[model samples]
Target: MQDRTLIFVLLLGLLVCGAVSLTVGSPLPAADLLLAAMGEGDPRHRLILLEIRLPRVLLAVLVGWALGLGGAALQALLRNPLAEPGLIGVSASAGLGAVIALYFGLAGVWALAPAASSLTGAGLATALLLTLTRRGDTLSVILSGIALSSLAVALTSLAMALAPNPYALSEMVLWLMGSLKDRSLHDAATAAPLIACGSLLILTAPRGLRALTLGEDTATTLGIRLPALYLRVVGGTAAMIGGAVTVAGSIGFVGLLVPHLLRPLTGHDPARLLLPSALGGALLVCAADLAVRLLPTPQELMVGVITALIGAPFFLLLLLRRHLREALP
Candidate 1:
């Protein structure tokens, strides 16, 4: 009952923030003007409400939700709070795929070029990660992820360095920074189904995830099929994180922070954290998007930049606490 109340309040807060984001921007539309625009909106006003603002807001919410859920699941499965989709080369590999497609002129092959390449790359990286760490130690898995991420980033840099077209280089740089600017309905549509399906898969695996709370040997003793469960978790994570990066270009740290913020409410139970973490993540990102628009700045910061700024300090705090704990007798 308490959990439901907390989730309801968080979700309601997110909805309110989202509505406020729609109403406020440069020149800051009046409340009456905003309502009038919504009622009998002119093309210009409607375009601002729908195309310019709404897509940015929605994409932020969706990406944050996906990352938060995926991160919580990964941490639960690995029993490591540091486990995150981006930490494991997922986002880097997806960025590499997108950069390659753009560099090769394949990004213009169709409307789906970027999405297809990103999904493919994420899938490959995930497969490599699983293979390298199959029944291996946690430290080994983390090392493998770091190696893969380094390789992907290096390749992405090489591609950008060698690109013959300045336009392609410009696009690649913008993408690596991660932004939700000027996204269209097509981008949203392509990613939505994948995120939905991935989220469903993660949510459905609660039983298996809970089983994993026991040691692997004990889980096996209890008749859980480790291989199948791992496949489902990895595949679902790839789909959502890959599709998200495809559209939004590597937004960072929502995965890392959202779960931490909501875990207190979940009593540290991975099962209970999933839905609440997703909601909290959506709210955080939507609130950040609102801040980006409301801030008095000449240039708009990417949503990713805002998250990293907020998250970096939190990450450092966690590291400090952990260090202190380890140092204590």
Candidate 2:
């Protein structure tokens, strides 16, 4: 009951933040009644607020939710604090898949090309990592993911170099950097269902995650099927990550930061961590999205750049702290 209350409060706060972000820019009057007087403002302003800005806000929420949930699940499964899409190369692999589809003009012909290719790349990377980790230790899996990520990035670079049209290459580079500019309803619609499905599976399987935290032998004693649970979490995270990259072009660090940031609030219980992390992630991304818009610049900053700026130092700090803690005792 208390957790439910917390989740509701967090969600409400996120929504309020999103609402404020929505109203901050443009020619629309800030008054509720005035803004409610639809069809009264410049059509472009109205469309910008309603169609462009709203969808981007919503996308930030959904992407954050998926990334947070997936991160928590992966961390629980691997029994590591630093595990995330960025560390494991899932985002890079997904990017490679999306680039392949785009370079071949598959994305231009079929709206689903980017997503399908991303899923394929993610699944393949997951498979390769699993296969390479014969003993299935955390270290082995992490190393495999790193190797796969390097390979994927190399391939993506090759594709960019070979792109037939410079314009297409330019657009791909911009997209890879990540932004919310000119997003539309269709972009949200494509990724939402995939994220929703994956989230449902993770939320429903929290008991298994809790069992996992005590390690494999203990979880097996508790009647948890280790292989099945691993598949569900890993595969579900792949779906979530792949879908997100397909739409947003590899926005980084939300998955890496949200779970750790909210763990204290959830008492460090993975079962409790997942949902709160989702809400926290939504809040972070929406706030960041608002910042990008509010910043005075000739060109709007990439969302990924902002998140990396904040997250990279934090990541290094975490590693240093961990090293110090280990060295102490």
TM-score of each candidate structure, all chains considered together: 0.87, 0.86
For residues 1-329, write the lDDT of model 2, one tens digit per residue.
37888799888989898888788776566754245437555666667777877889988888878888888888887888778866667789988988888898886799778668877887688676656654535566678778888999999999999998987788678878877777788888878987888788788888888988888888889998776776667667777777778778877888888888778778889989988988887887788788888899898998888877887898789879989999996
Each prediction's RMSD to truth: 3.1, 3.4
lDDT tens digits, residues 80-172, model 1? 777888877888999999898889888677756766787788879988987876663456567877998999999999999999799989878
lDDT of 2 at 274: 88
C-alpha lDDT of all candidate models, in order: 0.81, 0.80
RMSD in Å for model 2 = 3.4
Span of ten consecutive residues with least summed lDDT in model 2: 31-40
